[model samples]
Target: MDFWNRNRAKLAEKRRLRAARLQKKSNPSSAAEYQEKCKEASRTYNAKRLLAFKKREKRAEAAEVKHGRKEANRRQDQRETARDYKVEYELMKSGAEDAFRERVMHAMWNPAPGEYRIQFSDGSYKYFD
Candidate 1:
């Protein structure tokens, strides 16, 4: 068993050395080829980055759209609230003014023109007459 393990380790080391030698036997490339490979890698990296950026931008746009809709709805609700308040204010003002006018009319019931008098229903003349 010890010998088998030693042989296995040696075989693995030899295989690794042979693979390294094969890599060392590769053909050399020109500067132009190296630059072209660099450019290709850069292009691939930039394409991936651009795709991620576009996805992020799309998500941001969708969020903005949702926020815009929410804001629009909120503004609409505010407007409706303001309109209702205005209507209620107008109604209250009109009712108060009507009551004031009625009171004024009741207090100024002189039978003759330009005479601030008070003639009772019993035909009695008061001090205001």
Candidate 2:
């Protein structure tokens, strides 16, 4: 059994080597053609990869610009809110003490259900229902 197995293995190896030699002699141009095709494929793959990278960079730049614009707008909105609050505070400080007290009393006396008084920067009160 061991002798038969060794003989079979040697026969298979000789058959494989013979087949390889036959194939190499039969198709000599196939190797060069394969290498040319591989080079072309690699070139196209690199071109596509570079294009994708550029597109990704462009998108990232646009996103950064968009984020910057949004941040600027947010800062502008915060500044406007602060300015409005400052103006309201100044108006409240500049008004006479008696007038302020009278307005508060008037609002308290006219308290309506489900309505709240909103004081404006101009020292005027309005009911928010």
User: Candidate 1 residues 32-54, lDDT tens each?
Assistant: 56668889999999999999999
lDDT (10s digit) by residue, model 2, range 8-98: 9999999998887677567868656766888999999999999999999999999999999999999999898668556544434665546
Query: Using Cα atoms with residue i matched to residue i, what is each candidate's TM-score against the true structure?
Result: 0.42, 0.56
Q: Which stretches of candidate 1 lie over 4 Å from their true place?
A: 1-41, 96-129
Model 2 scores worst on lDDT over the 10 consecutive residues at 101-110
Residue 96 deviation, candidate 2, in Å?
7.7
Candidate 2 local Cα displacement, residue 82, angstroms: 0.4
Report the Cα lDDT for residue 120, model 2.
54
